[model samples]
Structure formats: C-alpha cells, structure tokens
Target: MNMKWYEVAKIRMKELDINQEKLAEHLDMTKGAISHWLNARREPSLDDIAKIMKYLGFSEFVVNHDGTISTAGGNENVSNLIPYKPGKEYPVLSSVQAGCWAEAIEAYTLDEISEWLESDAHIQGDAFWLKVEGDSMTAPTGQSVPEGNYVLFDTAKEAMNGSLVIAKLTDSNEATFKKLIIDAGQKYLKGLNPAWPMVPVNGNCKIIGVAVEAKMRFL
Candidate 1:
C-alpha cells in the first residue's frame, strides 16, 4: 500500500510528538505551504521532503516512483513501503554495440533481452545500462569507476560539463566512458586512468548519454 506524503507527514508528526505549527516553525516554512503539503494541495520537492524527514529524525527516505513516501530509521519498517514493482528496466549494451546505443536500442525488442538490467528507482527518461568492460577509466587513486560495475545513463538528460558520459567517435565502432571536460575552449573526453590517452571531441564525436548512477552487483 502506498502512503501519501501528507499522511506520512501527519504520522511522523505524531510519532515525534510535534504539532503542525511547531513543525512549520522549525522548518522555517510558511504555515500555508505546510498546510498545502499536508492537504496534498501542493507537492514538496525531493529536497524539501528530505529536509522534513531529517527534521523528523529519519535517516533514510525514498521518494517512490508511484508518488509514495517510504521512510527508514530507528524503528520504522521500510519493507512494507517498498513498491517492488521491478522498477524501470534498461538494456545492457556491450562495449562494441554501445557506440551506436542510441540507434541500436530502437531495434531491440523487449522479448529479446537476456542480458538486461533493472533500475531500482524510477529514473526519468529513456535509460540504458552498460557494464564496465575495461580499465581505461579505472585509476589507482580510488576515485575511478571500477571494471564490471554497471552504469546507468539517462539519454534524456543533456550532458553537462564535468559530467561522466559515454561517448564514441563517429568513425569508431566502440564507446568509452570518461569524464567530459571542457577547458581552454576545447572539449575532451578525459579518462580517470592516467595511462589512457585523452580524446578530443571533434566534429566526429557523438555523446550517447550522461552517466547518472552506477550499481555494483555481486551475484
């Protein structure tokens, strides 16, 4: 069962022994805004929800895809709140095929997926998954993405400067993951590993997607 944000807010207030006015005052928010949130007239942003949950002494809060609130910390049982809808599934592409991921994904049928992965959260936009294939982006400084980890890219999001992105050269048949760097009026795909050569994003280069999140699977 999904609980609305307002219901969760009321329950948390009761559990914390605080009144609505006190909560509104403590959060430095207007009473009407708080009331609006409580009455489901206005939805709070994720940041606002996090602030409210933290103020209420919750350490973990998940904004579920189905517009529900799930809390965990102390004595709260989060298992009941998880929707467990298998989340959003994405296509896992190989290094060679990842270069043309934008085009290749359209040709794939859902039934043909044996090597696919699922998102644990509701990610906005068309997303795709890729397994780290090489150590080109792996560095010894312990800040690099390790090989075999799964990276989720949102094609709908524009690649911003300093964002990790999957890019491919127009003439190449493979895709590579690196930090997108723009310095001195030049764009370059910079890898974490010092051993790997930096590749310039000329007119022949195409960005696939901005890497949003990565997951590690032990099984």
Candidate 2:
C-alpha cells in the first residue's frame, strides 16, 4: 500500500540525513508544527506537503485522490551518513488467503504486506503484525486486548504457558491471536474473555510468534 504523506516525508528525511530540526529550518516552519504533523496531532494541507517534498529534494510527489503519497525521479542524496541502525521490520498481513506467513518468513511479497511495523525487540528473528479482529482476547478485568488493536510479535520467541501468541490450528489456514495454555502436556488456545471457551490444540498446532507489543489508536 502507498504510504501517507508524512511517512514519505520521514523516509525522505532519513535519506537526506536531515533531522526534524533541520527539516523545520529548511521549510522555514516552527519545529512544533512539524512535530505535530509527524505525530499525527495535526495534518498538513496538500500545499504544505508539496513544500515539504520540494525542500526534501524529491523530484516529484504524486498525491492520489485517496490521500496516499509516493515519490519518484529523485535520488536520495545523503551528504552526512549516519550509522546504520539494524531494526526488524515486520509486514502486516491482511488475510489468510496470502498463505501462512509464519510458515515461510522470507517469502512474503511487498503486495501481501498491508503496512510495516518496526520492532524495538531487535531479536535475531523475524516478526509480523496481526490486526485484532474481535473481542475474543479482551479480558473482563486485567490486560485485555480489545478488538481493533494491533499486535506486534517476535517470531523467535517461544510461546510459554500464559504467553499471548499468534497461532494456527493444523487443519485451519487462518492465524489467530490468543493466549496459549499447556495443561497435562496438552496444549490449548485460550481467549482472555471469560465468555470464550478454551479450545484444544487439535491436529497440528503452529505457534507463529509471541506477542511483543500491542498498539491501540483513537481519533
């Protein structure tokens, strides 16, 4: 998917070795205004985005009617090189039709990815983002994962008892986010909500990844 204008601006800044302070200076705008736009506290008009793009030295920026933005034609010229920070970026999988992403970590294509999530865990493994579809993981009292949140997971981390994980039953192609439980050497998939029943891990169960972070946004 095409990124929003601010995301493209962030990539441009990184390419040009310019910090937000320098970007504000180049745009002749207050740092606070720039910060607001970056943090999604406010949005810039199309004209403002154009000006920011020009100052970032992009050859051209195409804004679609749907508000997505992309750049073309200009090379990213970095005069000051910063140390490369190796962070794990996970692709957001949108559907089970895309196949089992957890089964083949390196085979995911750009088109299958809905968005990207950068993980701070920095573990020596891959990661992915799963969008919570229902309130099955919402607990009545503590640590509820409400519906419509995003969960970031580490593929290398083992899912222990009581650990929340992304899992799929052997017979099913779809992946699910839920708490994992092991009892008497039998594994089960569990929901935090009291109304949901604990499901046995029938056939073959695949543990994709362990939950590392959960994000919820309101507007």
Show pairs that collide, candidate 1: none
In the range 131-208, model 2's lDDT, one tens digit per residue, is: 677677878899788877777777898789998988765665657777889999899887888888888885677887
* Runs with alpha carbons beyond 4 Å of true place in candidate 2: 1-88, 95-107
**Per-residue CA lDDT of candidate 1, range 35-143, in tens?**
8887888888888877776666555567776657666432245444332333457887654222222322232575765677765433457888877766776788966
Could you tally the backbone clashes for each prediction? 0, 0
Q: What is the lDDT of residue 174 in candidate 1?
A: 51
Q: Which predicted model would earn the best TM-score?
A: 1
Which sections of candidate 1 miss by over 4 Å?
Answer: 1-47, 50-86, 96-107
TM-score for each model: 0.58, 0.52
Judge candidate 1 at residue 168 and give its lDDT. Answer: 70
The lDDT values for all models are 0.68, 0.68
